[model samples]
Target chain A: MKSLDIWNRTYSRAFLDDLPHRWQRRAFLRATVKTATVIALAPLVSSLPGCSDQRSTSPPLSQAPWPTLAAVQEILLPHDAFGPGAADIRATPYLHALLQTSDFDPEERQFILDGAHRLDDICQEQHQRAFLMLDPALRDPLLRDLAESRVGDRWLGALLTYILEAMLGDPVYGGNPNGIGWRWLEHTPGFPRPSKGLFHA
Target chain B: MTDHYDVCIIGSGAGGGPVALTLAQAGYRVLVLEKGPWLKTSDYFKDEIACCRRSTYTPNLRDERHVIEEREGKNWKAQSTYDSGWDFWNGNVVGGSTNFMSGFFFRLKPQDFQLRSEFGPIKNANVADWPISYSQLEPYYTQVETEVGISGRVVAHPFAEPRSTAEFPYPPTAEHLLSRVFDHACEQLKLHAIPTPRAVLSRPVDERRACEYAGYCGSYGCATGAKGSARVALLDRAIKTGQCEIRPHAQVQRLISDDSGRVTAAEYVDTVNNIQRVRAKIFVVACQAVETARLLLLSTGPKHPQGLGNRYQQVGKNLIFSAGGSGRGEFEYADFSTDQAQALKQIGPFVNRSLQEWYFINEKQLGGKRKGGTIDFLLRHPNPISRAVGLRRDDNDELIWGQALKQRLKNEFTRAQYLDYEVFCDWLPTDDCFVSLDSAVKDKWGKPVAKIRLNSHPQDVIIGTYLSNQAKTVLTAMGAKNISGSASTSPPQNLMAGGCRFGTDPKSSVLDSDCRMHNATNLFVTDGSFMPTGGSVPFTWTIYANAFRVAEIIKHQL
Candidate 1:
């Protein structure tokens, strides 16, 4: 069973907005977004040469629902002017690696993969096309509508949770490469970071 | 072959550390049976996934789980921790939860020993006076400061307990710029803001290093051996004495007692799942509060049919957790100058401010004179994933994606510095809240697990709310925005105490004044379980002090 109690507590207190702020200087926001995107995506471009070896060891990205899952992730965190998008952070690959791990919860992994297939089915029913075939403009509205449902909401929440992990987790976990996420947010991680081991030794 | 020792300590946390150290140093053979792994300082890191997301420091719920009985309307419903994911096990490693604690150390006041006498008992609360007084534990508290490495600047506050020493052994840690703002606000509000004491080292003490000012102090293990965890401070020194033997991954099953009710040996399952027995002159049970009670309840002998110390059915009664809530206030960088903004964004320095102004409430609303609580102010933890996860939902509780989500993340992360406060009040012991063995559920070892019934006294919430509001007033004075906090009945799993209270009367309490089991002369419980009334503070400092005091008594007996 899903831990509804833990989820509820986390969600309810998420947006306490304990310190309200006025959003002034849209130009400053645009400049920071452009700078962050460049700095965050630099490592991905540099690491492109090593992609073939990683792809040979791992499952191919062309796996049926993986393409659909990637599409959903892109919509959730699109390549906007604000910062590096889901694709820039390699969120799909990080998630794929996480699900493939032995320690990862099998039930949760199944839930995520099943949700991607369900999203495609919903798209086919509503728009007479698979989720990937749907127009880019039409995708956000459908996702918003899907958020209103129980299963859809949890599915989206799960995806968003993994997305955050990919964005902010340590670089050793196959995400946040070159400390891109940390650089973007000016986050200073604690010292003696996990380097030798995959998780705890 | 069974190994014999002068003293055998079960569990190697705060309660067991001092006993092992003191006994071993005094030329006695001390054996510490720890259920967890012996993780060294080099093994610790600040990985958020390993420390927080995964059960790296604790056992998986699938193997060992708890059954929590929470109130539902008039009836109570019990749920396994495996299903709820509400892990009851703190740190299952060598040092126990002390390895993960933020190290906020506070001493109990003199009145806390005699809560019933200081203020008349509340209705339905099992309030009682302690057999020992603050004066008795004062020197040991000082001992913990010197021995366990406490660092703070002591100032005269409204509720400052009588101390044997004028100052802490070590100087206060490096402070954040926000502490100045907190002090100024307290000065303006006519409130005394004391420097919060920490068990972390401010300077290098022998082999142990000083605090590196790592932002991940709580939840994450100390990589530098700066935090005064049981392993780093006490157990390590005990090992150096060559008289202490710490056997990790030795899960104690039960204590074998003779017909005379004296514990002869401890039967335990080793790492290889082989049952091993260790005979000792005296046995000390310090498996935390819940497990201590569960161990006692499971060990039913010929003389003790009910349990070891459950003759009067007081072994697993009157469990307590620290009652309080946490709140945060944000300081926007836009409202400050460039230098001020830069200072606000600086990480790593500690925010060591706390308020005890309302430690004693004197108002008509709370019946004129009553107990209040402590408000500790700190910087919001710098865990990026936790912060990003919190920003996933919008104001309407709907999932926000795309640009909206990105904007929210940026604003929440880089735009402001958040100052948070945690309130600590007494979780008044009640008859409803206690620990028992669950018959239906069992651990991986097939032993019955602890079933805890959680029920807080109504006055606890009242006092908590009063303290929370007072904390918000401080935040407001500090020019903070959108300050919010509330007290709830849900217990903080880490700060647990009681269940095997120590007192003068054997019929009413499990342990005697010296913390020795009244019925079983050779058995003693040294954890927070001996606390009859947990003060309005974290129990680590008091537990360490009392254990040191108990160690002296055990030395005499040996």
Candidate 2:
């Protein structure tokens, strides 16, 4: 039941106020049972911090030629059966913004952008198709070749790892919106307070 | 723009706040200048984005973002060291690091002071004997303990220093579900699992309230004033005394010294819109490690061109950082999140009597053999996003498709345990990993920014490796699988110690055993920078103890 429905049923402040002095004891017992039940489900409810504030969808990804980057993201983390596609989910846009920001290392940013371009070139040469346009079988092999097979670019592997991590980071960073990846794996996104460090094991 | 005072204390956190309070209480005209703005407790939030991601604690990003660089002659040094760890979450506001600290407080063991006398000096380490012993500082520790209202159980560990104390103000933090498992595991291995000493009040004591166990103790300021921070505990007392004045956002640029080399006044730029000058009879640099070193290095005069206390080229040497690692366990009957309230449990600076050989001492070798750094195991509080990101197990684990894979993970998570380790050891004092001015790098105030040059010793690496391996052994015995993590040996040194290290000799050390700088007869440093050797115990308690001791010294000497 929704919280409002449950609250309306057993926790009407009016009902308690109207109870006779003798019956007040029984009413308190009834309230205790209801409060305990509400508390037992509190973890699922209270773990969410600022989750209600993240109600809006991401901004549109309509500028520039990000097709190759979008294709790679989809191939690595395909639109799941339950969630939005990789490009449509704002992973690339978020990655673009983080890389462009002053917070990230300049070298790290250049490596990521350059690696994506290099990866798309290899895909086009091998299969005459953009990386996203290729079948999973062909795209997977091509990505592996670029990521590991002594591709002249030493930072290729690192770039791939960075992209993957960015895609998987907390949605508050603009990736993994609405816990799409979490929902796909049946995980509940618990709002953790950082100052508190990690919660108890 | 500002008036003068008898004593001027730079930095308003742990070291600065107390001295300000004590001196003001004793009727000294004092001025406490904090570089950062004052943040109200309510303004502090639990958002990782605004705080952790943006580096809000030490923000002014143009100067704080550090990158690892390989200098041609020196190996990789912290290219911009002042703010490398600032990203992890430290308070830059009036409270200093204490605003974001977990409030874990522990006294140094008696052996920690006489490392040279207890443990033989290892090659490539500058482990020196502390001027004062635990006994001398014991009374002051209790005074701080009462003032701070620490909650802990004082169980005598064989490797611990003997204490002439009673029990803590409150019992240990209740063993949440996680600590019970950790305690059970350690009991089987005979490793003593002592109560973790915390500055968070377990029961309401003094004006401070009891901890709500809200699980927001590390990075954010406690809203309820439960955590014993300088802002909540003592800063108010200092201001109320009317003898002390705290000028927030007053960034001290340089110590204005006369031709005689005595610091007569300090020139500062008030963040609020004015140039300021404050003269004082004495100055105390309690602004924490990096900034404290930076301030001293920036203060140059005709008599001391190399900076006020850099005559020996030892101003910013001996930097140490408390090191950390993590381990995980998988149990058949564990539901990691079942008991939600117990998620804040922590293990302790337990004893390791046989590990004395792993340490280093600068003076005579220690004859009585026993040493151990603090080991902490905080339960891995994986929110759903963090869980999905790192939730993995290796067993040639059959790839169960879609829904089944989800179910498998949920099941495994319900039955898993994790342990994180914290090791505080002495880092060798190196002249190279010191601070100097980077003329090119300027802060918001146009003052020359500090270039932090820091690197770890090979012995620290060895100790880190040893601790990592030992953590796995304890976890393996508890039937946990896939335990891995290293104490990082990269750009950021996690355990930074020894800049302006304390010693008996004035020529070699910045401060006397009493934390008073020798050449500058009226200055003293009581923060982590004065530590001769980093003990396994956390630095806050020691810093507090020394601050009290130094305050007494100043009271009597003056």
Against the true structure, whose TM-score is highest?
A: 1
Across residues B63-152, which tens digit of lDDT does each residue of candidate 2 receive? Answer: 443332334564553444332323322556777778777676777778888887887675666778888888998988888877776878
Worst 10-residue lDDT window, candidate 2 chain B: B347-356
Flag regions of model 1 displaced more than 4 Å: A1-58, A198-201
Give TM-scores for every candidate, taking all chains together and pairing residue i with residue i: 0.92, 0.74
lDDT of 2 by residue, A82-139 (tens): 4444553455755655554434445345545655555556566777766567786776
Per-residue C-alpha lDDT of model 1 across residues A116-169, encoded as one tens digit per residue: 777776787788898889999999898887777655677788788878888888
Clashes of each: 0, 20
